[model samples]
Target: MAGPGQRGVGEPPRLLKIVMAGESCVGKTSIVRSYTDPHGAPTSSSYLTTIGIDFKVKPVMFDDIRVKLQIWDTAGQERFHTLSTSYFRGAQGFVLVYDITNLDSFQGITSWMKDIHEKAGDEVDIILLGNKCDKESERVVPKQKGEKLAWEHGIPFFETSAKDNVNIEDAFSVLTKEILEKKSCVLYDFDVVALNESKKRTCCAF
Candidate 1:
């Protein structure tokens, strides 16, 4: 593991590979754009569509630790299911998104979570994000229900508004921090053979 201030001149300190999975038009892209370009003006619409999978890298500082987030935005179309599974390889964390105004999107969370756990393992870190929180009048899924679902799955949940920039940063920040903490703990466990070999080598030199 690379510590803070130890990164090479041009290289990043840590790489966090995260994947955003949800139904189409659930504001996954908007959330990514808002975090990556917070100051940019909102556009009326954008026709950009993720073919198999699209990636973006953004550097963020969490409690003095610099982290480079490798975000993968996946296609939600049913026809692309075969292609999307391939992108799940080596994903350390996940952001399961759902539109607040769409009930179907919320219902699909179960299947999506199962797919992620199957591909990345049950130990993989995950965060649930309810997008379009600003649209309260049109919300079909209640906040308490979403929170309950997240609790049942043992994952953190947040209501985020990409349009208003509400809790968007907090959601990602917490998930990233959790990922780093888990990674650090795993790195502390040393192999018995490696430790014994080093001790023997030191004794011979002396």
Candidate 2:
């Protein structure tokens, strides 16, 4: 991962805007910090809730491409919901985080997903993240339940611990790959049309 203000030369890296959404105190901010600055020390578990939104940008290499992710960590409180939901606009993907230790947090994914789609559109890519896996004893949301929810909705899923740094990169990587794939499809269609146009012009010239 490239540090802040650091980027590779050549073509400009594609910017991918992503949002972290879930119930309050689900470690959304921690996940953003971890993924953007993996070398930094892990965030303490007792951090206060986000007020409105936190933002970060990190450059990552995937295959031959470098993508700069614009991550928005939105507040999960009900009062901030309106303000947070506005940030969902133009986001290419979302990380719906929930704490495994809190059953209410896990159950809140349904409503979060609903709001995300309402603002960002249904085609936006999403991943179910069960956070705080390090506290195994406190885990109330079983892995199966999370997996089932993911499967039922056909979205990718992973268990992550912001403190332990578990599956955090995998979750982001999966979402980025989906974004890149969609971009590739659109570019390929343009190329096909361009090729057809060239063929028609050459035939007319002959």
User: For residues 38-141, what per-residue lDDT tens digits would candidate 2 score against the true structure?
Assistant: 68845647567898988998788776576778899999999999999999998898999999999999988999989988999988899999999998999899
What clash count goes with each model? 0, 0
Clashing pairs in 1: none
lDDT of each: 0.81, 0.85
RMSD of each: 7.4, 8.6
Q: After superposition, how far is residue 41 of candidate 1 from its true place, in Å?
A: 5.3
List model 1 lDDT by residue over 1-206, tens digit each: 34543433343346788898988878777788888888983831463656678888988776556677889989877888767767777788899999989999999999999899888888779999998889999999999989999999999999998888889899898888778877542221134456788999999999
Using lDDT as the measure, which candidate wins?
2
Q: Estimate each model's TM-score.
A: 0.81, 0.83
Give stretches of model 1 more than 4 Å off.
1-12, 41-47, 184-206
Query: What TM-score, to 2 decimals, does candidate 2 have?
Result: 0.83
